[model samples]
Target: MSILDYRRQSVRTAAPRRLYQAALAALALAVFVLGTAASVDGCTPARDPRFVGTATCMTCHKGITASDLRDHFAGPHAAIDCETCHGPGLEHVRAGGRNGILIDNPGDDPFGATPDLCARCHADAVDGHAMTTHFTKGAASCNDCHNVHKPGGFVFASDPDRFLDNAGYVQLCGECHAQQTGEFLRSGHATKDAVTCGGCHDLHVPATFTAPPENNQLCQQCHASFFLGLDSPEAVDFHTGAFHPVDPAGSGASRCVTCHLPPQRRTNQDRGPHDHSLLTLRPAETNALIAQGMTPPPNSCAGILGCHDASVPGSGAPFNLDHPSDNTVLQRFFDQIGGIPEKVQ
Candidate 1:
C-alpha cells in the first residue's frame, strides 16, 4: 500500500498544478494582447506627444469668450474631444493658447482645412457640398452657414420652423446674394412664408435653370397639382398645349422657372440671373415694361433662350423689342393663345 498509494497521490497533485500553470499562461497572454490593443487604440501622450488630452486643454479653455471649450462640453460634440477636430493642442497650450498656434479653428479655414477636417467624419456632406454653386463660386463655406457647436445650426427644409426663423438662414445667404435676396424678400415666397430658401434651393447640389427637369422638380414639390394632371382642363392645356408645351417630368426644354423667373434684361442679357420674385412674365407685362421705357427691356416671353427663339419652324427670331411691330405681334400671340392659366394669373 506504501509505494502504490504515494504514486497515485503525486499524480493527482501534479495534474492540478499543471492545469493551474496553463490557466496562468492563458491569462497572461490575454492581458498582454489587451494591453497592446489599448496602447495602439487609446489616446495616450506616448502615442503622440502633441495630443495632451481634452482635460489638459480644458484646464485653461473654460471661458466662452476666449474659447468655446466650455460650450463645447454642452454641444453635439460633447462626446467628441477637442483635439479630434482641432488637431493636437500640446503646442497650443505650451504657447499659452496663442491665437495662431497649433490648435485648428475650422471657422477660420472653412474652405481649405475645415473641409478636410470635417471630411474625416462627414465625408458625404463635404462631397455633396463640393458639387454646389457655393463651393464652385467660392461664395461660402461650411462654417459660413453652420454654427459649429449647435445642431440647430444645420438648416434643413423638412424642419420648417428651424429653417424659417432659427438663425435667419435666408439672411445669411442674402449676405452674398443681395439682389436676389432683396427681390425674394418682397416676393410671395418671403411675404407669405409659404417656403424658405431651403424649400426649393438645395444648398448642396448642382442647380440652375438650364437643367429643366431637375430644377422643375423643386418647383413640383409644392406645385405638384400643376403636374399631377389634377388641374382644370384649361390648366392642363396651358401646360402641355401647343402654345406652352411644358412637361416638368419630361426631358423637355421648358421649365417653370423659365416662365416665372425671366432674366432681368441687362445690357448683356445672357449674363443676368433669372428673377427670384417668381412673377409670371407674360407678354402683357413685358409690353408694359417695354412701353415704360424700361432700359434693357424685360424679355420674359419672346426672349428666353431656347424657348420661342428662331429655332422654331414658324417663329422668326427672338424679339428684344428692337422694333414696335414685334411687341404688337407678341401681345397678339398671348391673346390668341388664351394667356396663362387663371391659377397663375
Candidate 2:
C-alpha cells in the first residue's frame, strides 16, 4: 500500500501519557496566571515596584525632552501624578525596561489595558467615547485621538471655543478621517471664522459627533438673526397665518435634514454617514422630476412638501429659505459641481 494508505490503516487511537502531563502543566500555568492577575484586582500584581515620582522615573528616562518635562509638570495635567497612567515604574527603572513595565500610551500598553483604564481618571470627561464605533468596533484608543503628555496637551482651539483642539485637531483627526476633513474644510463652517473640527464635534463622542445647538436645537443657532443671518426672523416670519413652519417641534418633528441634507454616496470606504455638505437640495426629488423631463424651479419651494394648495412639480425649492444673495451663491456653486468639491476614497 502507498504511504498515505498505510498511515490511515495504522492510526493510534489513544494520545500518549506525556501529552496528558503537558496539558496538566498548561492548565496549572493558566490558573497560576489568573490567580496572580486576580490578586491585584485587574492590573499587575503589587510584587512589582511602588511608583516613586517623576524625579525617580526621569532619573533613568533621561531622553525625555526638557519641554515635555516642563509641560508635564506645569501644564493642565500637572495635578495628576505620572504613576496612575504608566503604572508603578519602580521595576521598569531598576530592570532598565528590558523585562519591566514599559511606559507607553494606552494604544500600546504592554499589559493590554482597555479604554476603561482611561475612563477611571476621566470619569466625567467623555460621556460616550467607550461605546463609540471608534472604540468598540474600530478598536481605537483614546490616545489615538488625544495627544498625551505633551505641551498644550489637548486640542489647539481658537477664541471663544477654548476647548477646541483647533491647531492639531484637524491633522490628528484627519489621519483616519481624510474624506471628512476635506469636505469639512470646504464647508462654509471652515470658510467662516470661529469654527473648527472641535467647534462642531466632540472627539470623545462617536464617529458622527454634533455639538449642542446642532444636536438638540434648531439650525437657527447659525441661521437666525441673532447669530449670523440677519434675514432669519424665522420666529416672526414662519408664525404668519398661512406660514410654512420649518420648526421640527411645531410641525411634527420634521428635521432640517429631512429636505436639505439627506444621505449621499460614500466618500470614505464603506462608512455610511451622510454628506456633511448641509445643502438644501433633495437629489431624490430632483432626479425623479428630471426623469419625467420636468424643469427645476429657480425659486419658490412651496408645493413639494404640500405647504401650498397647487401642485408644483419637482422638489419645489423652499421660498425665503435664505437671503437672495445666499441663494445666488448656493445655486452658482451647485450648478458648477453638482455636489461636494473633492470626495476622497
Highest lDDT against the true fold, candidate: 1
Once fitted onto the true fold, the runs of candidate 1 whose alpha carbons sit more than 4 angstroms away are 1-49, 73-75, 154-167, 208-215, 226-234, 239-242, 246-254, 266-271, 292-294, 309-320, 332-345
lDDT of 1 at 101: 67
Q: How many Å off is the CA of 186 in candidate 1? A: 2.3
Worst 10 residues of 1 by lDDT: 153-162
Assess each prediction's global lDDT (C-alpha) against the native.
0.59, 0.45
The sequence of per-residue lDDT tens digits that candidate 1 reaches over residues 1-345 is 799999999998988865654454344344434444456456444256556566656555556314545655544566776677777765665555545467777767646457777788888878878887778888677877766565444422222224445137465777778887777777787888766666666665665322233336656655557544424435545663466555545543445666566777533444567687876566666557657786434555644453544433354657645445566677666555434464455
| TM per prediction | 0.68, 0.55
- What C-alpha lDDT does candidate 1 achieve relative to the native structure? 0.59
| Candidate 2 global TM-score | 0.55
